[model samples]
Target: MTTENLLVELFVEELPPKALKKLGESFASQLFEGLKSRGLVGADETVTSYASPRRLAVHVCNVFATAPDQEIKKKLMPVSIALGADGKPTEAFKKSAAKAGCADLIEKWPNAEDGPDQLYVANDGKADAIFLRSMAKGTSLLVGLEGALEDAMAKLPIPKVMTYQLEDGWTTVNFVRPVHGLVALHGADVVPISVLGLEAGRMTQGHRFEARVDPVALTNADCYALQMADEGAVIANFAERRAEIVRQLQAATAPLGLKPVEDDALLDEVTALVERPNVLVGKFEEAFLEVPQECLILTMKANQKYFPLLDAAGKLTNQFLIVSNISPDDASAVIGGNERVVRPRLADAKFFFDQDRKKTLESRVSGLAKVVYHNKLGTQGERSNKVELIAVGIAAMLGNEKLESAVGTAAKLAKADLLTDMVGEFPELQGTMGRYYAQHDGLSDDIAFAIEDHYKPRFAGDELPRNDVGVCVALADKLETLVGLFGIGEKPTGDKDPFALRRHALGVIRMLIERDLPLNLDALLFVAAGIRGFSEDVAGQVETFVFERLSGMLREQGYSAQEVDAVVSLKPQRLGEIPKRLAAVRAFADLPEAPALAAANKRVGNILKKAEGEMGTDVAPDRLVEAAEKALFASVNEIAPQADAAFESGDYTASLQALAALKAPVDAFFDSVMVNTDDPALKANRLALLNQLHRTMNRVADLSRLAA
Candidate 1:
């Protein structure tokens, strides 16, 4: 079979900058997968994707001109239905054979009782009569490419669509943008296909101004990228273009003794927006620096796709770098235009900052009354009040009554920034603006930091609140969200978490487990529910949700499912003890007696679950009949205390190891003892003995989870 590399491209009006990278990747991968599924390409073949502002393309290696022929067998109608009373083919069988393009073979069809093909019977005692067995011809590259391209286009992650008319003016097409050209090549030959009313060709437009020629002609599939660069003046590959920008930014900023603010998302957007990138240095007036540097950096990155520079101490400077699509001999006009344009943006930031400081954050307390938090949950003012109460209670629990005043003050001012001019203009600066305004109000540093840090750990892997006061406020805020939302029955289902309750739950878990706070999770949840006047049952639901999130996070952190299950299934009140319990379980699993012990523990759990009446942990040695039962009771008496002592001392590994000595007695007891004997006292005593063994084995973790 002969093979050749294939090339595909779609040239269009500039794409959405943020979605270009994903679109290109999806297009290439989907096309490759589609071809491979049809046996047109092999698994080992390589695929290279190219994306620019105006085009998306892919080059796939080792593509076949046609897919291999396949043998197909399709089961037709039931034998009773296809055959008439005279046992001959009926009109229905004729139609089916014609539909399958095998009309001439209908007369040759054998009866179900004596045919080479197998017959399938229906549940009604009727047999499916016809089986069409034939060879299917392969599709040529041109035809297969058309279907593949259409499928890939339909599956693109387009955020929005635009409708434009073709040259005929009567026909319109919807796409991410108006597509002007499509190129499909197999080796040196054009595998002609059409998309968005444009026919496939070998020529595509390049950079608007810098291209040496208007339409760069691709000679073959292998030379597309090289020709695109040499004649089109465009770096077609997205990753390559991004890397080039990074290199140019480094070379440009090194001489200025500054560094560009690092944001991968910003870099990718810029790469997608320009085909021929030229980095230029620009600067604004130093007076604009009086505004917060965060405002300046954010404005430069968000409003204009400019990279702000930072000094040696990571302080924002007036200088920034711009990636331009054009390169001129003087370059002064381009640099001056960017500087002039950025001056007004920076001036607006300074104006908002100045206007916001006119009123202290303390004065904004009453302003929250009109701002509704949730229709069911009341206003932000009411929410703040609830948070204040929760924070004070948490502070007391941490043995720090001094934090009550600070936490209350911080919680009161946390949402105040939402009403400020700076925050209104840039909603991402809510907590940060509060911190700045609080300092201007002559507030203590502790209170100011606490207000800003109250929303910490907003996402996964984010830092927690900085201090005890911040911890109190953050915990209160998150707990309020969980309790209030769960109370209203707005829990997340599937992928829809409009309120980010899962994130809040993970934040609470991270704070408790990472900070090793002595606060009990259940107590905090119950108190939070109480603040909202919610049912006490919400605590159990909230606890289960938090533990589930913890289990997933721990598994992601490289713990095995069994280890996590062993610890999390116990539902220990002190979440901080989970990691210790997991460590202990892992250590015990390495012991020589672990498998037998885990099996015994599981058996004991099952026996206890099925046992009738009250099964107490108290075992009377006098009631033990068999020597094995006596030996097991005696071993439990000796080992239970040692395990309990080690557990209380926080030596979880030592505690679990102490139970390792029970394997022999446990196996022997289960083998010899009849726990369900007719004698009432003896049965109860045996159940009690097993109960003691179960309790002692599971102190560190639910060892039954480790059972295979």
Candidate 2:
């Protein structure tokens, strides 16, 4: 048989560019799959997806011209249930039996002597709507493709689906936008299908400005793409359009003493903006070049879609270029229009710079408190107060008096620009604006830097604190946020982190680990206790919760979860020292003889977990064990304090070193003496030794379960 193609077009009002491709792809694939599973004949297939920022269409070829005959599942009721005890047809089963075209046909095919078999035939009809409805009923016991396809369309995935239309506008379907009509045909025959209220037809319109409505018929499977091409449309993939834009942009800018700006994202954004890609060279005032290149570039890219260009030395070239759908001759006019559009944006930047410089940055500081931070979290003024408090505490701890004011000043106006109209409109500049304002006011460079750097590393793999002042204020900012939220019992739960406590915690981690700063969570909590509104219990709970974030962070860094648990199990108050301790423990753990020593540590842990709140610091070593056991106990007594000293001082390497001293002695004791010895006094002494090791090891990290 000669191959025949099928075509469909859901003409719509202006559709969101982002959603057009997604909806088109989904409709084509889902419809194709649905038809295939129904045993439809589609010898070869291709789906051409195209849109014009207004309409989306999927043209399928060599697609099912008609459904193929196949066995279908049919359901039958037991005749015994269908008939009444009086040998009369029951109304319950009679209606359904009649609809199935088998009124009382069940009597001729009675249920077997045993009982009903409960089998079903999904569809038993000619290839058309009647068959589709039958197949739509769930064939599988569970939800099959029927529900999946419908559900997939229920909440159309991708952008712009949110702006639902009140009336089923031009699209003919009630959707996020108004629809126009549906054009569909199968093997030159119109397939009866309705999508978004648009009925199947064989005609499609093209380029609202370029072509008229035409009844273009797809000839063959391969003709689909070329057919759409003739309709003032390119039915090729989006990636082709995306790449073509880049190539043309480069070529257009090549002779203009400029080069296309290297920006993949900007390219992607531009691609979504145009249907037929064309690059047009444009020019701007060379005098505007006196302004910073970044400001000028931002103006063109953000406001005009005109990509800035640079010469050999990377100085801003007065000319810029843009991509438009029109021809080269037409684009010259478009370029002129874009260049004219960007002039005002550049002028505004220059004016803002001039106006900002008229006054000192100090004058902007007063504007900070007026800025609202959060509805309930008070103004930036209140957050400023918390930031200053934290900075002061950290400064004193670091013994850096110079950093105190810089840190405090940075904290004071960290959010100063939130009050500025610029930052209000462009929130990304909150910290950066504050830094600019502070520097303009003639504040010390360090404070200005801190103001800007405090929010560094906003997301994963971002830059972190770059200076002592920045680190101090950064830690304070993150800690205060974590504490304030957790105090109110607003912890992050699976996929819902309204407060972004995890990022704040990560910032804290990167600051400590990357900067190698000495910090005590206990000390940090004590400072957090100063937040004023928090209760003592709330303060403590928030503190523990933040500590858990650290624990989880460490575990993710390839440390054993059990190893982290061991150290945290010690009622940890100082967590900044944890990573170092874990590293040191991990290092010592890798020693060849570490397993037995780890076993000793695990045995020690088992004793403590089994103690079930039985014991305290009072270990009765007066009840001595055998001489060898006594020697091991003496060694533990000596090294325990050394380990404690190192741990308390945050010298975890030293702590693990001291703890490693016990490995040999403990290994010797396990080999020579049994803790469950026949003598009660000896057993008690060995138990005391185990407790001593547990307590000492607890100072650094719970090494018992640490993986080598």
Candidate 3:
């Protein structure tokens, strides 16, 4: 067998910039996997992916020219059906052998000793069957590569497909972009494959305009990247190009004592838009700075794919960096072209900003009525009212009338930005624009920031609200969306979260746990449910959904399943207390008596559950006849007050530590005394004692969950 490195490239029109990275990775991996599965490549072979604005390619090392031949077994039929009692071929056997194209081989099987290798009897699970053994021919590189190419193309994650006619003008093909050429080479020889109506060749275009040669010709798989760079003026590797852009951006900005805005998404998109990156600085008029820096920076990054520079104080500068595909001498034209292009975009943003400030947020509050929030949940105006009510109630619970007034005003104006021209133009600036407009209306910073911060912690790991009023409004807004949506049976199923309900639920969880707010979870859900007049059961369902999200979050934070189960099984109302409780549970588990105590606790719970009547925690001391039971009762009496006091003082660790003293007595009582005694009075007293012991041990967390 002979092995050689292989290379494949698809030359096409520009690919979708946002999807280029994934497209390249998927194409390379899928092609490599396809070859490996067919035994044409070894497990340790290396693969490199190349993606540019106009090409997708891959290079695989140590690929075999043909897969090795394999031995195959084909089951014929049961032995009973193949041969008669005297061991002669039956009619059924002849028909099956004829259909298998082995009738001539089967005729000599009984007497010819050399034909033994062709047919044999083997158990095919249920019965002994006659099997035909044969050798399969190896797959040549040409056929295998064709199948692999077809498989890779079929599995591409194309965002959209385009239908275009080939050069013949009669045949059409569907692809992400119109394909002009394909290069498939095994070593120096073309592997002869066709895809998307294009034939394999060594010639490929490069850089559109900056290439030193008209058509770059690759020599071998190993030299493809080097030749492309030297002759085509293009960097073929996606990651390499991105790193070069990053390096150039740093070099361009370092001398100015500033840095480009660090956004990986913007960097990737810009990297995908060009093949040979040349970083250059461009500037806009100082008058555009009057508009909010967010609007200016967003327009530059989102619309023009430019990297906006920021000063040392984190303020947007007048100059931004451009990643041009061509590096020309005296590059003033490229710089001037970009600057001229961005001036109108900035002017449009400034116009929208100026127009939005004319009407106050309070004045626009009524305009939200015309905007439909959800078909089932009335309009944005109605949703705003619900959020305001929940916010005011939360503020009152936290304390102070001034805070309640601020939260109510913030909630009312939060959705007012939806009606603004600036926000309507850029929906990402919804909360951001509200803050500016609120400040423009001569409102206090508290109200202004709250109106903006109400949407804080919008995604995972995002910052929470900055002020107390913002906290209340944020929680109220998220809870209203959660409960209202769940009430309408729009719950997320699997990955189909159209409304991002899971994100909303997680936001609520983060605020509650991170802020350590004293509000109860159930009570807050009830307040959020009140606006829609939803039933209590709906609120309970929302609570369960929130706890599920919290449980997953805790596990991700490195807590064990048992530890999380112990704490969350109680459904503690105050989510803020969970961290302290988990810490206490962890500390209790480290004690020497923890294992025995957890087991005893589990036993006690099972006994209490099985008892006929309701078992009260009140233990009658006189009825404690056994010495072990009496000692256990005394231990519980002594430990209960200490644990209860520590729990009240918020020292959960001390509360759990106090229960370690009862382990010995509890173990001895369970060892000697039967909880279900013959005498009814004795049994009742024992059950009550065990009930008290269970309650004292599980205050911080359910100890029974840790029994395993």
Candidate 4:
């Protein structure tokens, strides 16, 4: 089979910047996989994808002009149905062979062997079957590449598509942007395929302004990237363009003694916007820095697609970097134009800040009543009240009455920033604006900090609330969300969490576990359920959801699934104590006796589960009829109290370690004693003894979960 490097490019109008990278990746992966599945691509071949504002392309090396032929066997039917009296072909055989597109040669084919390898014999309730073998012709690159292009087009993650007409002005095609050109080259030969109403060609237009040639011509698939760069003034590869931008950013900032604000998403967007990037530095008036740097940065990055530079102290400077499409010889005109464009953006941010500070957070509290939190749940005002109550209850439980006032103040003002002009302009700065307003209102530092930090740890690995008041408020806020959403039967289902209840639950888990807070998760849910208009029945469901999140989060933090299952299966109320319990479980698993004890613990649990009723922990010595049972009872009596003491002292490792002494006796009891004896007294007593063992062994975690 002849082979060559293949290049496919779909040139369109400017695509959505955020979706460009994914679009490029999917185009390359899906097309390559489609070809490989058809045997047109070699095993050692590799693909490189290119994405820009106007194009999505892929280059594959070692692509075959024609796929290798495949040999396949077809099981027609049972021998009785497929063959005549002399083992000749029957009507059913002819029909089956025709359906497989090989009727002309079926009679010449050898008889199928009567063996287990034949697929149809077993299903047809026969020991023998008829089979036909044929060689399928290889598909030409033109036909295979067309199908691949169609499949790739169908799979692009285009949130929305546009319909346009080709040159004939009657036939319509749908794509992300209006389709302008298509390039499909197999070595130096055109594959002769069409997609999105455009015929494959060897020519593609380059940079809108900087191209030396209008339509760059490709001589072969291997030289596409180099030819485009030399003549078209465009960098086709997304990663290379991004790296070049990064290099320019670093070099540009080095002379100014500053660094660019680091944001991968912003960089990706800028890279997608320009095919030929020119990084330039622009500065605004220093007076605009009076506004919070967050507002300025948001306006610059979100609205203008600029990278705000920061000084060595990590403070936002008035200077910023712009990734422009054109690189002029003088460059001063570009810098002046960017500076002029950004001044109004910075000025608007400053205006919103100045106007928002005039209104106090307290005054804005009532305004939240008009904003609905959810249709089933009430307004933000009502939500804030519930959060306040939950925060107060948590503060009182923590025995910090002094923090109740601060917590209340913070929770009340937390959502007030949603009404601020600054926050209205930039919703990402909701908590931040509240803090600024709180400080402006002469509130204490703790209260101001709480107002800002209530939404801390908004995402995974985000920082927790900084102070006691903040902790109380953050917990209350997350609980209110979980309780409210879960109560209304809005629990997350298989990645469809419209309310972000999963994130809220993970936030609650992190605050409890990472902060070492003494809050009881069940108790917190119980208190939250008692709040007005909330259902108490959903408490278990909410608790399960939160613990489920914790289990997955712990596994992600490097804990094995078994360890997480062992610890989380107990549903320990104090999440803060989980790390210690897990530590103890790990330490116990390392001991020589852990396996036997764990298996015995599992056996004991199963035995108790089969009992007629509740088996009390009181093991009567008079009913200990077997020598093994007597020894086990004595061992439990000696070791359980020590384990209980260690458990009470929070020495989980020691508690689990103490139970190691009972492993041999436990093994003997299960081996020799009949837990379900003929005598009712003996059965009940044996169950009670096992119950005692189960309780002692599971102080830190359900050891049975550790059994292999």
Candidate 5:
């Protein structure tokens, strides 16, 4: 079969980055459906889409050369019968017959039982002019539809939009980004034919400067690889661009006795930055190293799109690798240009660092009062008070009396850097600035380190706080953020997380789990008692509410709702103990008969709930009579202490193992036993044993909520 390719290119001005990605994907999806809906499927059809700041292109290959070429029926009638009272088809029967093809095609419409039985008219020889006009009308309707589509996309909620090419004259297309050029093709033909007041065509301009108007011809469906290479440009596929940048980056920077800094996000950003990438090395004054290495590298990668070079010892080098759009003839000149741009960025950073050094850590602490924590909660000063409370409470809970005062002191100043000049200029340096200021102020090693460590695990898989004071302050800070925001009804909903409460909650979880602190979340809530955001009663309530939210926040770390519920049900005091409980439940979950075990746990729960529907805590153990009941009772009594010890030792699996030993005995007792005996004492004893079994099983996990 002979093949033909249809390429449509829509040239516009620069489009928003976000819109470029969205429009390309949306236009392709809609066009595919539009053609299919028109009953025009090309034999073995395919479409390839491409986009840049200035243009959008799509190509279709192996088109049918013509549509199915099926006959379409048409008919006309006298104005009185087929037309309206004015001029068009008048009678329903006549209009129906005309629409169907002819009067006979309607068959015995008003007379037949089958209803609307019509003649099978021969439409193959019908004149094309009739439906050809109809097709033109459809095309006009489609133009309107595409206009609406563009308006809808522009109105989509986004952070920012740039509209240099909006045809409506106002120009600012309200989108996360701007919409630039668009080209759409269907088998070498324009699909909707017109969009953005521009007709779609087969010609595409390449690489702005390289291909210029090279036609980007394709023998089949468009592949940008050859087109880009022939045009002295890089093909802009992210994956291909990433591979090329990395390979050449490694080769280019190797000669400098340094390796390219491994920053995945920066690498991904650079991959999107250029149409054709040319990796080269750039250098800066080694004296810039006097500034914090983090600030130096952040200045480079964050602003200049450069990757910092590091030696084998992992020390920052004076050199960096830069990915450039243009491959220059003089590599030295390009490097010189990059050095000039980056020099000022690093200089400002150094100035900020030096200015921050003048203030004592204690002086900076007072400035935190000006930082807004949340609108509902007052200022960072009020928030810091709660952190101090949390730190003291966790210290007491963990029996770290030695660090209690120190933890309190550190927590008070942890966020003080937020108001510092260094952090103001470089928002990423909030915690690091605290540590630097603390050191400059001649604070003790522990306090300065605590200031730095408090914001640990800012993201999932990031490092956690390493010191006692750091862990305490970290928990206080996170719990305050969570409870304060959630109390004011600022909880995250759908895709909106206005306060980053989820990340704060996850940070708390990671700090607790990784630090292994013996802190009770409930007790921490009590310390948050002094917190100014909500009532004492509501504060306690918010803590429990935020606990569930925290568990949800840990979802990305691989905890499921069932797993989270089971952990929460155990009433683990320290967030650190959650992982241990999660591991135990996960292990129990792996067993083939885990479903049965969960059933056993739930059965124990249901029996106690029914018996003690209104009973208070502390069931009396002496009211036994049934032999089966007494046997189960003694077995549970024997296992509770051992399980308790195992749990205290953090051997959750061992605790469950001890509790499961009663499973066989309990199962036997259930088979041979009659719990609801005539005597209320025996019934109460059975309920008490069930409670003991439930409580014992809960020592490791509340298996009732766990999934089989």
Candidate 6:
């Protein structure tokens, strides 16, 4: 085997900026694996992926020019069908061997065991079979590379395919964009392969406006990136290009004691849009700052792909940074061009803001009737009414009149911004514009913030609502969405949550737990369900769905599966208490008596489940006949009150620890006493006693779930 570095490139029209990173990664990895599977590359070799606006390429080191030969085995007919009664070859054996290209072995017979093509008898697990062994030739680079290229191109994660004809115009090919060239090289030699109607070559075009050469010619496999940069004026690697953009941004902003807005996604998009980046400063009139900084920043970044600068206080500045693809001695025209384009966009935002405040959020409340939230669930107005009811109920549970009033008002006006011009233009600013408009309407800061913060913690690790009223409204809003959608049987299936029901459920869970709200989960669901006239079964399904999300969250936080199952199995109403319960379970598991008690608890549960009719926890004193049963009853009587006291005081750890004293009695009772006795009275008493034990042991968590 001989080894050398290899390079593969596909030149096409400008690729989708959002998908360039993934497309590059997929192409490189799939191509590498394809060659490795064919034994043309070592498993430990390194691969470098390069992606830009117009190309996706990969470089692999130490790839073999020829794969190693392999030994192959072929199974012929079974022994019974191939051999005669005296263990001699029959006519069937002769025909099979000749067809297998081993006819020489048929004539050689007994002497064929030592040749390149040999015959042997082996059992294939059903019956005896004859096998022929041969050597397979190695694959050359030209053949292996062609197969690898096809596999790689077939598996590219193209977001959307475009169909275009080649120069020959009769045949059409589909790709992310029109293919122009393909480059495949091993060392200094072209491997000579064709893909997507283009033949492999060393020639590839460079920057459209600033390349030193018309078509840069690569000299070797290892110099593709450097040569492209030096002669073609293009930074061929995506990560390297992104790093250069970051460096220029920092250099451009450091002199004024300002920083560019930090958004990885925006930075990646800009990096994909440019080949060679030149950072320049551009500015708009300071009057545009009268609009909300979020609106201006969004317009500039989203529409123009410019990096907005911010002062040390995190306030937006009038100056912004532009990443130009071409560098000229006089860059005034480019800077002016960008500034001219952004002013109209900012003016539109300011216009929407000025016009939306002309009417109060309360006035727009009636407009929600025209917007259908869901066909089965009525309009947004109806949804807001449901949320208002749920919020008041939650506030009443908290026993605060002021909070209840604020929650009701905020819930009514939360969705009013859906009809506002600012939000209509930028749907991402729904709750945001509500806050601004509420402030302009002479509302208090608490109410205004609540209107904005109701959609807090929208995604994972996001901030929760700030004030108590915000908490109530946020909970109410999420619960309404969950209950309403679930009532219509539009639950999330698999990964397709078109309505983001899972996010709503998780948001509800976070508020209940993080705020340590003193509301019962079932009661809250019931309140929302009642408002929508939903059945009890819908409430139950929503509850299960919420708890499933909570279970996954707890596991992700590093709790063991057994510990989480033990606590979640009980369906504790106050989700705020879950952390304390899990901590107590972990502490109880560390005790020396934990395993025995858990096992004994499991045994008692199984025994009581098999008893006739319903078992009561009323154990009569006179019916406790056996010594083991009597001792167990006595121990339960002593420990029950202490455990109940600790549990009532919110000391779950002490409560679970109190049950450790019952371990010995529980074990001895199970060992010496049989739960099912011939005497009806004794069996009934034992069943009642075990029921009492099971109930007492499970107050904190289901201990049986901890059993192996």
TM for every model, in the order presented, reads 0.94, 0.75, 0.94, 0.96, 0.78, 0.95
lDDT of 6 at 108: 72
Kindly list the per-residue Cα lDDT of model 1 for residues 1-708, writing each as its tens digit: 899999999998999999999999999999988888777888989999999999999999989999888767777677777889987789998888778776666655553333333333344345444666566788778878888888888889999988889999899888999888999989988887887787898999889998998899889999998999999999999999999999999999999999999999999999999998999999999999998899999999999999999999999999999999988999999999999999999999999999988998989999999999999999999999999899988998888777888888898898999999888889988888888999999998888988888998988878998888888999999999999999999999999999999999999999899998898999999899999999889878899999999999999999999999999998888888888999999999999999999988898899889887777888888898999999998899999999999999989999999999999999898888899999999999999888888888898899998989
> Which candidate would rank higher by lDDT, 4 or 6?
6
* Cα lDDT of model 5 by residue, 224-330, tens digit: 44665565364644456668888999889767778877988887667656667788877888888988887888888888879998899988988888888777677
Instruction: Name the 10 consecutive residues with the lowest summed lDDT in model 1.
Output: 111-120
Cα misplacement distance, residue 387 of candidate 1 (Å)? 1.2
Report the C-alpha lDDT of model 2 over 99-146, residue by residue, as the tens digit.
Answer: 775553545433322222222223334221111112222133012223
lDDT score, residue 162, model 4? 88
Best by lDDT: 6
Q: Which parts of model 4 are misplaced by more than 4 Å?
A: 80-94, 101-128
Which has the higher TM-score value, candidate number 4 or candidate number 6?
A: 4
Model 5's C-alpha root-mean-square deviation from the true structure amounts to 8.1
When 1 and 2 are scored with TM-score, the better candidate is: 1
Give candidate 3's root-mean-square deviation (CA, Å): 2.9
lDDT of each: 0.90, 0.65, 0.91, 0.88, 0.66, 0.92
Clashing pairs in 4: none
Candidate 4 structure quality by residue, lDDT tens digits, 1-708:
668999999888999999999999999999998899888997668899999998899999999888888876766777787778986778888888788776665545443333322223334344676665556788888999999889988998997988888889798878888988999999998888977667899999899999998899999999989988888888999999999999999999999999999999999999999999999888899999899898899999999999999999999998999999998898999999888888888888888888888888899999999999999899999999999999999998898879888888888888999999888878899898888889999999899899899887898789999999999999999998988888887877886988888888988898898988888999999899888566667878889888889999988988888788889999999999999999999999999998888888887788777778777999899989999999999999999999999999999999999988997898888788877778988888988888888898887899998899
> Model 1 misses residue 499 by how many Å?
1.2
* Model 6: colliding residue pairs: none
lDDT string, candidate 6, 1-708, tens digits: 679999999998899999999999999999999999888898999999999898999999998889898788999899899889987889999999999999889777656677677988889999889999888877888899999989988898988989899999798988889989999999999999887888999999899999998798999999999999999999999999999999999999999999999999999999889889999999999999999898899889989999999999999999999999999999999999999999999999999999998999999999999999888999999999999999989999999998899889999999999998888888988888899999999988888899999998899999998998889899999999999999998999999999999899999999989888888999999989999899878889999999999999999999999999999999999999999999999999999999999988888888877787988999999988789999999999999999999999989999999999998899889889988889998889999999999999999999998999
